[model samples]
Target: MRLKNKTLATWLTFFGGPLGLHRFYLRGFGDLMGWLLPIPTALGLYGIERVQTYGQDDLWSWLLIPMLGFAIAACALMAIIYGLMTPEKWNARFNPGADPEALPGRTNWFTVVGIAVALMVGTAVLMASLAFSFQRYFEYQIEEARKISQ
Candidate 1:
């Protein structure tokens, strides 16, 4: 059995999880999700571009926004999950045949980095979403106040 590096897998998941690079690294070409995730992402980008050109009337473009968000959020969640997994469990699952004595000590810098990136990105996305909602709310309030005055 091929011994997979846990740190490497975690890093790939952090950097390219949405593209399923970590899945490929762990399970090779048999991981269909790894191979297929890019399709919707590319389609979403195309839809977004079309929407930008033609405006909100493009219903497909609006759908792509949620698709892209789900994909990105899933990746970020996976990074957190992988980073938190213990090395013993990782070895048992992914490097079963390897001698425990030969396995490298798991001072995983990749896991640390993955956790940091996931936290920062997740926080930023949450903050941005909240900011956009608040902006819209205030704009609506201002519009209501103007109509009342008129």
Candidate 2:
């Protein structure tokens, strides 16, 4: 019976955590992961891109290029963190056979799935934006280099 709320929180975090909903459930764990996770996930992806393109002489500028890449990598790390940190929340959210009377709303599985899907989709969009910014910074570096050569 007491496990019902915890189960719901777990399901919510496990499923909809990327978008930050899981933190809302547990408050402490949720907030901590929410703030910390995305930064790494985004940055990790950026770091990978940096390795791929750092060979270009003009692309190796100090703050402008590396900063963007760092941002992306941090974001990627955060995504992973987000997913990993929410396991407790997921467990709390989806104990299917639990007593409804104890926990209040039965909280249908389909609804949980929907929320998770939305969180994932939202996360994808944010990542895309991060990628776009990273690309834009590189493009700016290319343009700046071209001007210098002229």
Q: Quick one: best lDDT, which candidate?
A: 1
lDDT by candidate, in order shown: 0.68, 0.48
Candidate 2 residue runs with Cα over 4 Å from true position: 1-21, 27-107
lDDT of 2 by residue, 58-85 (tens): 3433223444334333333433433343
Give residue 55's lDDT in candidate 2 (0 to 100): 43
lDDT of 1 by residue, 1-150 (tens): 567876677667767876778889888979899998776667667766976898755555655644554566667777677677676766677777666534431536666887788878866654554564455456667878999999
Poorest 10 consecutive residues by lDDT, candidate 1: 98-107
For residue 73, model 2's alpha carbon misses the true position, in angstroms, by 13
